[model samples]
Target: MFKDLLKTHLFPTSWCPGCGIGGIMAQLAMAMDEMGLNQSNSVVVGGIGCTGRMAGYFNLDSVYTLHGRTLPVAQGIKMVNPSLKVIIISGDGDLASIGGNHLIHALRRNVDLAVLCNNNEVYGLTGGQAGPTTPQGTPTVSSPDGSPYEPLNLQGLLKTGSRYFYARTTVYHQVHLKRCIKEAIQWPGFAFVDIASQCIENNGRRLGFKTGYEMLAMFRDKYKRAPDGVESLAPLEIGLVKRGEEQP
Candidate 1:
C-alpha cells in the first residue's frame, strides 16, 4: 500500500543481509500509510545508530539528531508545531543507553511522539558490543565471559506513568508489528513501540542462530498471545497499556 512513499533509489540497503532492521523499516512505512500520514506533514527524527539511518532512507521530513538526543529534537518539533506528527526511530544503545534520561523525561511529560526502539540486544554498528538491552549473561565482544548486569525492563519503566501507550513486538510478527505501529501513531500522547529486531551478522551469530530467519522462527516458537487478550508472551508483555476507564 505504501509503494511510492519510499526513495526507491536506495533499494538494496546497506544493512547486513538478513538484518530485521529492513523489515521493521518497511512496516513503519506501511503503518504510516494505514494512518493516511504522508511526508507532507509528518516528521521523523533519528539518533545515531543503525536505526538512525532510517531518516536518510524515508521520503519525509527527517532530522538526523545527535546520539541519544532524538527525543529532545522530536519534542522541540512538536512544541513548535503541534500539527506535525513526530516519529523517532533509534536503537537500544542510542535510546536506552545514551539517551535514557531524555526518554524518561519524555514519557513523564507525555510528549506527543511515536517512538520505535529497535532493540537488537547488541551495538550492531559498533562491532557488536553489548548494549543496554543485552540480556544478562549474553556473550559479546565487550562481555567475553558473559555480561554480569541485568537489562533494563523498558515496559515496566513506561508503566510508571499511566497516560501513554506502549507495546513490544518482534520483526517475526510483521502483521502484529504493523498494527502496533499504526495504533502507536494514532494515540494522542507519547507512544513507544519496542521492536525486537535481529542483527544476523551480530546478535544472531552470537546467539547460535545462523541467520535472521532462524531467529524469527525462534521468536515464533517462543512467543504466544496471552489469554487476557491484552498481553502476549514474548518473555514480556506485548500489548497496549490499558487505562482506568477500560478497567472492569
Candidate 2:
C-alpha cells in the first residue's frame, strides 16, 4: 500500500511536467516504506522551495516552515522528542542559500537528522534563479550571462564534523538514490544526501535540453559509481562516502 503513504488525491502535482522532483519524492516514499518510517515515528520538515512542497504530499506528520527556518524547527522537534526521526526535505537553494547558516551550525552540532536536498542547481520555485549549488558559468535568470560564483561544496561542508555521512546521487540512478536515503536515515549523526536532479522546465530548456529524458541521459553518461572505501567522491563520481556509526 505504498499509495497510502502519499496523498494521491493530489494527482497532478503542482510541479511542472517532466520535473525531476517527482522522482525524488517517489524514491523517498519507497525508502520510508521499506524502513518502516510512518506517521507515528517520523516527522518531515519542509523548507520553502519547490522541494518544500514534498512535505505536504506525505501522509506522515510534516511541518512546512519559512525559508531558512526548516533546520531550527527540526532542531526543536529533535530536542524535545529525541526519539522521533526528524527528516528534512528541501532544495539546494533552501538549504545552501538563505538557510545556509543553519546548515553549517547543524552540521557542527551533529544533529541527528537526515537532510535530503534536491540539488537541481536552480531556484525552481522562484522563476529559475541561480542557486547556491549552481555551477560556475551556468546561466540562470539571476545569472543570465552565466553564474559568476563557484558552487558550494556540500560534501566538504558535511565532512566538517568528525563523524559524517554524505551521499551523492542523481534521479536517473533510482536504485542508488533509494539506498542513499535508507542509509542516511540510519546514520547516527548528521546525514545528507545531495541528490542531483533536473529542472527540465526552467533549467533544461534554457540549457538546450528538450525533455527530462535528455537530462536523465546526461546524468547517466556523466556520473559513475565511486569505488568502495573511498574517502572522498570525485566530481563525476556518484556513491556513498561515510565515516561514522558503522553505517548503523
Best by lDDT: 2
TM accuracy, model 1 = 0.94
Clashing residue pairs, candidate 2? none
Q: Model 2, range 1-248, lDDT digits (tens) per residue?
A: 66778998987899988888899889999999988889999999999998999999999899999998889999999999999999899999999999999999998888999999999999999988998999999999999999999999999888886788899999999999999999999888889999999999889999999998899999999999999879999997999898868643
For all predicted structures, in order, the TM-scores are 0.94, 0.97
Off by over 4 Å in 1: 227-237, 244-248
* lDDT score of residue 61 within candidate 2: 90
* Tens-place lDDT digits, model 1, residues 86-188: 9899999999999999999998888888999998899999889999899999999999888779998887777777575778888888998898888788778
Candidate 1, residue 103: the lDDT equals 91
